[model samples]
Target: MSMQTPKQLGGISFGLMDPETYRDMSATKVITADTYDDDGYPIDMGLMDPRLGVIDPGLECKTCGQHSGSCNGHFGHIELAAPVIHVGFTKLIRRLLRSTCRECGRLALTEYEREEFRERLQRAKDLGEDPNDVLKSAVRQARKASNCPHCGEQQADIKHEKPTTYYEVQDVLSGEYSEQIAAAMQPDEDDPDDEGTSPSELASQSGIPLDRINEIVAGEFRPRTEDRKALESALDIDLTEEDMNKLMASDIRDWFEDIPDDDLGVLGIDGEISRPEWMVMTVLPVPPVTAVRRSPSITAA
Candidate 1:
């Protein structure tokens, strides 16, 4: 028998699974958070669904029809109600947001700058060199642009708060407007008969739910006239507020989708293998129970 020499490793690539791919690999859709029912049986479509592989010794996996010890287990998925930013990619998302045009979703750099960076990226790729430095420089240059070269729209400063929040900062209200607004909102102590609108009434009129108030305050939601009016009427204030719009995962995903494939290399992303939008999770993959379950010996120990 002849022995074959091992082949040399060329490179390694990591990619995120898009929603469709996640769904395709999932054994079942995990609809309920419950693991077991009242009878102690695994609930269908729950976290411990038999289709996701059984943890119990006697039970067989519903999907693979193998006993607990033999079954490698299958994956389950949960469809999120709303898109959310992946915590791991918060920095990358922020960098992408800052480096791209808010209006056109193109790189904020001029044509010459873009071409230059692209050339640098291509050279790095050809040489099998790390392109992170080139990407960082390109992103740094792009962030300096106040207006998008492609669409000529004024760009706002992209701010990333720790964990997962992102905000677009733009000046909307001047100092004079702020003072006038404050004065209008202040109650007139001299007028004994005046009863101002209450905070509850204003909140109700704003059409924003209580749960979303934090997001609204953090600039995740765009300001609407009704929302502004509610605060103004409640305080009896006339004011122009600064634009601190929150960028939600869905919004970011849309922006990423608009980015040209050719430009992805400059951003240090391989468009063919992965996409920026995939960084924002719409579907969550759940491991089978057996994979996560502790062995009886370990538990006893």
Candidate 2:
């Protein structure tokens, strides 16, 4: 067999792997979590599956049929127990979540606004200025929009929790009223006869029945205690259990790819680039076998 000289590379490309990409690259489905056995041998069907080629000289590599240093490492994959956000794209996730609407999953900008901003960005580019400056301005404006221009639903504030979690800042005002709240904002001053005017008399003055005003003053607006308890209990579903439901990597890839070009452009990403949501790591790439294998050190005799 004749060997061909390697062509000189012009540039290297890096990208997120969709599920199909992951499947195509993987040599085996790693069913066992173990990497090596007690004797340091690669465990069968484990993370260091032999189908992923071999690192030890004693065993023949399954894929390349080479021993030890002669074989290049092949990739094998283990299905994740749960989805995790990709650490690399934390900032991108925050930026995308904040700029897009939760309800409609669309950018907060109106069609007209996006067009205008697009023009501004292009003009800036033409003028030999940084288009990113214009993009940032548009993003700033979009972030302030509270409602989705497409859906008309209110947009909740997107918050980034520590260690790669995204949360919506839904400030649900408690409907329950406590006596402490009433006492904090006392409505009445000194009335000579502590028992203020009868509901009828107050009603006469305001044209609204004094009884109604009394109900308002006495905090009738507060939800009854039993009702509040029921509500609290009803909303107490376990979030951890909900998170256990696995989302397929392919579906997630589609979601990232589905974000409109204009929306991604506003976030300073061109259509050719992956969306910020791709930061959520669906597939993990394994290093080359040669990279992981420890090379023997030569010592001077």
Candidate 3:
């Protein structure tokens, strides 16, 4: 009978749901197995996650211009099974995305699924079931996959920024493009004909321009952003500044991205892919009290 403020729901003192609990308690429903596709196939792929309310209908959202983030739905439906997930409390249907098509349109969650999931979630709560497992399942299923709908460029939603010297640089260079970029930045012209090499490969090999191959093949490396135009001419390959920026924008800086799931080496970059620095820093009596780097592996190691 007493009203509790939304602000008082959680802080340092009490860890609880938002003060809008009564509002959220409205009936939420889960997508039943009966849900079907245009072909009469189960839209859920038979692997139903209770947490996921609906699958994303992979289509372009005309309103938002991009299909990745929240938007007021307004778009022509593409004949696609757009799987989506609905958050219980808010009944927010987040689209489950893969690689988005920049040329076509963005992803969108179905409103129908949102309402359905909310009802099911309310019922689950009333039954005194824990919401933790459902929440976790939802997280894994709902991976963030977004891109620029206009330029057809990949979205830089998740950034992998790193700072370091030797090993770290080498690690970053382990990616397919990273190695190509490193090789391109400093080309070896005197090494005779690079049989399968292309202007693009050359662009990646020396981190310079394919057009500037001759010049860069004999010159020092420059900053990634600046001096690209000059370098392009040196390579004599007609490489553009936009090309360099696209490569730079990619997750080429992440070595772990390319690393395979094994305890051993990846393609020849030998070593147990863990923190070698831990033993390096901790073992020495007067350990180097330098700035510590926090990578996913470092902390886990």
Candidate 4:
């Protein structure tokens, strides 16, 4: 029994449940929806497993060996057939997803900017100054960049549907960049500005480099290798040209599955936050046996 009133009681904090926490609290492995047998007895190993505790008076709880009202209801869990996004953290998820690059899965902030922000944060810590405002401002600035500096991929505007679903404005490769590549591939001799002079023809004709022209001609687009390598290490994948090609065709949902643990921690996830794609309802804690016991239905005379 708690001494504090409902208003004074500190509520439980909801967070991702690690396996250890889940298993320690669970009283029985619930497999079926049926709670009781034909005789109205709690079916063993069912949703109302006796191991969860005796819900009736005069019957001792199998777990705590206490009768109803004396024993608190034990915890039992339901393994979801599929994961659903946690409703509470929807905003956090949306912000983090938008702020991170889809291609490299890194924060939008460039390396130099990241270092500068980190140094400021460190200085603040050393000086015993509250860094909340500084950190917020830094994160805000980082999230404003429309393009990922590392991958050179323009970020799409994220639109979140009420409750759970999220969508983004995806760009077709053939739309904007294709025109630029086409412009780059146009011959210098063909350009009206080029006089076919004795001077530096290449420099005068087009400011774009020869290698860049070759890339356009070859129809080869390489993502920033530096960030790709870092992402590969985080995802534990080789990410060869072939892999990247395959990924280019896949949906963004697939990409979310490989986000690293460190990134999740930065997003305020504490422990073992694997695969941001689905929010797993891993553990379900049952109330005390006393809490589960229901009063008899009163019939009108």
Which sections of candidate 4 miss by over 4 Å? 1-15, 119-135, 145-154, 173-283, 286-289, 292-301
- In Å, residue 30's CA in model 3 sits off its true spot by 50
Model 2 RMSD in angstroms: 8.3
- Per-candidate TM-scores read 0.72, 0.69, 0.22, 0.56
Decide which is better by lDDT, 1 or 3. Answer: 1
Candidate 2 Cα misplacement greater than 4 A, ranges? 1-10, 37-41, 123-131, 176-258, 271-273, 295-301
Give the clashing pairs for model 4: 72-288, 72-289, 73-287, 73-288, 73-289, 75-286
For model 4, give the 10-residue run with minimal summed lDDT. 241-250
The lDDT, on a scale of 0 to 1, for candidate 3 is: 0.30
Task: Report the error of model 1 at residue 177, Å.
Answer: 5.5
Candidate number with the higher TM-score (1 or 2)? 1
Question: Number of clashing residue pairs in every model?
Answer: 4, 2, 35, 6
Full-model lDDT for every candidate: 0.78, 0.62, 0.30, 0.57
Please give the lDDT score for candidate 4: 0.57
The residue pairs that clash in candidate 1, if any, are 184-236, 185-235, 219-246, 220-246
Give lDDT tens digits, candidate 3, residues 1-301: 7798666445453222221332233112223334345553323322121111212234333323433233332211111132111112111111111211223322211234334444545565789986545443332322233433334444322212232111111111112333333455453677655444555665674465555644444443333433444443444433332211122211221322332222111111123433111111111111010112112222334
Residue 166's lDDT within candidate 4 is 71
Q: Can you rank all candidates by lDDT, best first?
A: 1, 2, 4, 3
Over the stretch 1-301, how does candidate 1's per-residue lDDT look in tens digits?
7799989989976787778988999999999977777766778998889999876768888999999788999999999999988898888898999999867789998889999998998899899998888999998999889889899998898888888989999866334543453354345789877664343443575555654544444445544556656655655655464778988888988989888777776887878888888998889999877887643433444
lDDT-wise, the better of 3 and 4 is 4
How would you encode candidate 2's per-residue C-alpha lDDT over 99-190 as one tens digit per residue? 77755567789889988887887788789988877867776787898788898977666666665666656534343333333342333477
